[model samples]
Target: MSRLTQAVVLLLFGGAILRASLTDLYLRYVKEGLRPFLIAAGVLLIAAALATLWYSLREGETPDDHHEHDAPASGAPGDDDGHGQGHHEPRVGWLLILPVLGLLLVAPPALGSFAAGQAGSVSAAPASDSDYPPLPPGDPAPVGLLDYASRALFDDGKSLTGRNLRLTGFITPASDGSPMLARIVLTCCAADGRPIKVGMTGKVPLEVPADAWVEVTGVYSPHRAKDPVNDVDVAYVEVTSWQEVPEPKQPYS
Candidate 1:
């Protein structure tokens, strides 16, 4: 790339690092599909800056010649425009090291237990009708597990007991052979999250391991299950089909 283009690339890469460091939203939502691209762009920018710097230093100068006696005297010190060009090309590249190191050393800690405590699901109240949106015209409306949880809890599981729904989440283990539990990840913070789980009977794919992303289509129903002191009494959501998906870039709680 041209020296000007390389300079712009370095500047933009530095800006991305600064933006990701300064804003939680950028780290969470914006980087979901962008981690590999961002890293590749950073590498390209660094390489271009180094190449430009090398070219600036070597241009118009033979290996055997320093300052020839016949060469015209320069106007003054620092008068060669190209002399200091190498110095600035890398300034932006150097600026990117900070955030890179930060992520490598310590990925910003997961959205914590504290956040989950504060942001308990709105469906916590079973009598609230406002938790659900109007169902579309169909036998089953494919919805997020969070939506199912909110509506189920809103009506004390009355509205969802017989309705078919689809939800996506990662697997969590249960004593039964089938995946009886699942959790959706929230990137930035748990306050904005509502991970919904189900205790359903069916064959969970053996290949779909815990933490593996999966989309599950199922029917929501209320069935009694053993309640643990630590975990809440969960309603069984029957599974019809489960398919694994790629792990998202911004994995979260």
Candidate 2:
């Protein structure tokens, strides 16, 4: 392709990278699904830029070469001194200023609570089929601590209505005047995450201070009546075991 075409391609690819890096949707969804496409676009852009640079440096009969008002061959057009070298305008290195400014001074912020409001409620609705194994009808059931927390906050304690779960996450203090609750994040997967409030009812260890990570095996039970989503009766779980552990990345469920 022509130098202009190559430059256009570079600009297009660079724009894609810039936009994706800045947008929230790209961070949340497109980051994973379109990774390969981004990589390919990067390679194509580099190749196009290099090809354009080579073309610019080569002795070429472009439209600019066919100018009527010229000097010599080596000088300008016709007035060749045989030793004179043609003078071309310098490449504008400052064209990269915009991208550099964006990278160095305007780094994107993390997806904050503002996003949670618009991202729509996460669906923890019961599976239509019996995909999940049936929980025992006994007093306590097996469940993840995070799962119970999500249910209590959003599903009205319905998540733990008849099941028990085992979950683990770091500890964070409840804000002043807030209910007695602990927060944990389930990140990239449900494993690494951001902290969401978990209502704490049963005895918590005194040794486990704020920010101390822990693995809590527990039985799901109702706690409060504040259901953020549907006003379903919310609840906390009975903590069976709590042991401190190191924090993991990808915090937030």
Best by TM-score: 1
What are the clash counts of all predictions, listed in order?
A: 0, 37
Cα lDDT tens digits, model 2, 157-253, are: 5545555555554454333323323333333422232334455556565456555556666766655544354433334666766667665332333
For model 2 the TM-score comes to: 0.44
Where's the lowest-lDDT run of ten residues in candidate 2?
114-123
- Per-residue alpha-carbon lDDT of model 1 for 3-118, expressed as tens digits? 44445456555555545545453445333555555556656666776666577456743422323423345565444567542112224545545654564454454342233333
Model 2 stretches astray by more than 4 angstroms: 1-38, 55-123, 134-164, 170-196, 205-213, 225-235
Q: Relative to the true structure, how large is the alpha-carbon lDDT of every model?
A: 0.52, 0.48
Give stretches of model 1 more than 4 Å off: 1-100, 104-127, 136-140, 153-156, 175-178, 184-195, 226-229, 248-253
All candidates' TM-scores?
A: 0.48, 0.44
